[model samples]
Target: MAGYVVAAILLFSAVAYFVGRAAGERFVSANGDQVHSLPGYHGAFVAVWVGIPALILVLVWLSAQGSVIDGLVLGGLPADLVAGKTPSEINLLLSEIKNVAAGHIFSEPTPEIVAASQALLRWDEIARWAMVVVVLAMLIGTMFVARLRLAPRFRARTEVERVLSWLMIACAVSAILATLGIIVSLLAESFAFFRMVPLHEFLFGLRWEPQIAIRADQVAGQGAFGAVPVFVGTLVISCIAMAVAVPVGLYTAIYLVEYADERVRNIVKPLLEILAGVPTVVYGFFAVLTVAPAIRQAGSLMGLAISPNSALAAGLVMGVMIIPFISSLADDALRAVPRSMRDGSLAMGATRAETMLKVLLPAALPGIMGGILLALSRAIGETMIVVMAAGLIATLTINPIDSVTTVTVQIVTLLIGDTEFDSPKTLAAFALGLMLFLVTLALNVIALTIVRKYREQYE
Candidate 1:
């Protein structure tokens, strides 16, 4: 019903736009030079009034109606059915009633439950129809009112601009609030984790076991929260990835910008960027089914021991995944340098290689560094490739052939099952997340500082 109402509102809004535009055109034909705003602005103003208010009403109504109906149904239930029930128990009962009402009954329900389900269904129908009526009335009434007010001096453009400005402000505020909310939640959960596990043990302890006995008789490892190994693994993998990606990506960008002709640039750039569009999961599969085995074989031939799931495999795949990010950004940065600089260098008898190496590289250093940092962040946060190719044992070793786990992989492992949120095991994920966020945030700040310093010098 709500969907139908929205469709009706959209159809009517389109009609209102054309009608308002025709009205504005008519006024212009009659009172030639007197109209304040263009006919398109008048149409937009009318369409905004026609759609936005009605849509907002529908949205608010739909958001609220389910809880309101549920409350009313629960209140109508017999007191004996709900007496002495805790909030969780009551919520479960309500869910059962809703399921029975929707014909998903797994067992027979009592008389009171049946009656409550009937009431729920009836109230839902009533609320949906009421919403539809109210939304339609608002749409039609606002359309008429806005059309009546459309005059030569209506200032429709000013009104439309004000609405758009407010919309943008609302979007920006919502994004900021969401980010703040995430930080606050992470801090709260991480604080809970720190209370349960000491900060020093988590930060400096050598072991990484997180298993804890949930019941007295259950067999489990003594919980260990030392995160040093996880942190080290993350650094080793990221470093390996950057080792492969930075030089290759930068060289590719240099070739594209300084040497390649238009046709070659067009073909090669797209083919290179297609790597970025490939899903990370596909890269994970490639690492596990292909790269890891090949690395193990190569290690065997060299009389070296290599884990089946090794950091080298994951790092190589991840580096390939990140090449496009560095390449594209570096390409854009190199292109953004002034053509006059290149011309002047050539006129000064400098070879193209000398001009590029001596002048263009330094000028574009900021953007290239920015891309490297971005790719580093991407490498650190990647989970699937690491999980598949890098084993989950958080070993404190830097050997690329040895298996190790990263912070992201540990966070995922800790939160994979039906775990209690209040448990240290579960809360540990939040602590890891908070750490990841801080690292990424620091990288971004550093990138911005570098960009700003170089940008000032160049400008």
Candidate 2:
């Protein structure tokens, strides 16, 4: 059924594209003086029109089909079976019944329940195919009608151009909308988690130990969810990443934008990015193999209990990963600062360093800050380096010598392997993600806000 729907949609879309293109050609020929846009616009516009409605129909039908089918199936069951059950209870029962009907080993089913389930399942499948056919027919009909008056003076060019422009706008909007949807979904799950674990406790708790067992019948320890320790680990690692990224990145930016010859810039820029191109997993292993042991041995001399997977190991590797991002962005931002500013400062008898630091860097501060904010955000959101290199123990201590976990690391640990979706351990990840998103979002917002407010506007 999915195959049939896919084929029908694709076939109709191609037909629509050809029809629209033909219409556009005729319109351009009939009224060349009347046309205000290119010939291709008519065809592309018609193709978009033909595809959008049917595509939306397919998406909508697919999304709701399963739930609607399940509801109707559950509704058809005998009154006595469903009378005492609330809707949620009925949903659970119906789900089990469907599994039983499918001959799944998870549940048992009687003959009568099986018969009703099969009937509803068949009806649902039929309805889906029926909807697909109807949409396909509508698309073909629209295309045929659009192709009818393809004369030169038909205004097809203008119409097609307008539609194409709006289609591009809609595509852009779709990406933005998807991001918003993801944020909302994460926020909702986090809200559910906060209800189970107090917000303050989760925020300030020094230890994190997520528990499993979704139902009351199963028992597990009441674990701590305080994220303060994990948050500290993230802060520590991000600070280290920035520490490495800033000096190297800014200097690279300085050389690239202000001093480097074109040939040198071309050769050096990609080589520097090759460092960024190294897979983070490789960096993780490098940290564990090379950095962690060294740190642990160094700590032993200082009378500290340094774990092999110390924060410094992970942080240093993460910093290496971020340096390219910082340099690339900072270089662009610095270069974007007007050359006129540099000229003015140099004309006033300033040395190269003075001109750069006082004039160019200041004017470019907003852009540079924006780049730092970008690198900072990347550092915080990083998962693999911390997961593989930073040990997954939540501790309140600030010592970089000790092992620590991050929000991302805990999220990975909490959700890794097999998981029961409703378990606190799994939900704990959503809570951590929520915290991470909010922090990153806040940092980005503040960075942009400050840059905008403090942006240089020299007379």
Give TM-scores for every candidate, taking all chains together and pairing residue i with residue i.
Answer: 0.93, 0.85
Q: Which residue runs does candidate 2 get wrong by more than 4 Å?
A: 1-11, 27-38, 76-83, 97-128, 164-192, 212-219, 275-279, 297-305, 415-428, 456-459
Query: Which candidate leads the pack in lDDT?
Result: 1
Superposed Cα deviation of residue 155, candidate 1 (Å): 1.0
What is the Å distance of residue 14 in model 2 from its true position?
Answer: 3.6
Over 4 Å off, model 1: 80-86, 99-118, 215-218
**Top candidate when judged by TM-score against the true structure:** 1
Model 2, 1-459: lDDT tens digits are 766777777787787777767766665677666765455666665676777777788788889888888777867888888888886787777777777656674545776678777876687778877887788787877777666655555566566667768879999999999999989988888888888888999887777777655568879777888888889988998888799889989999899887889999999999988987898889888898888888888878899888777888888888888888888878887887778888888899999989888888887777788888888998898888887888888878778877788888888888777767665677889988988888888988988797877674532
Full-model lDDT for every candidate = 0.93, 0.80
**Candidate 1: tens digits of C-alpha lDDT, residues 1-459:** 877998999999999999889888987888889989889889999999999898888889989998999889988988888899998889989999899889999999988888888898899999988898888789889999999999988899999999999989989999999999999999999999999999999999999999898878989997999999999999999999999999999999999998999999999999998999999999999999999999999999999999999999999999999999999999999999999999999999999999999889899989999999999999999999999999899999999999999999999999998767789999999999999999999999999999999999998
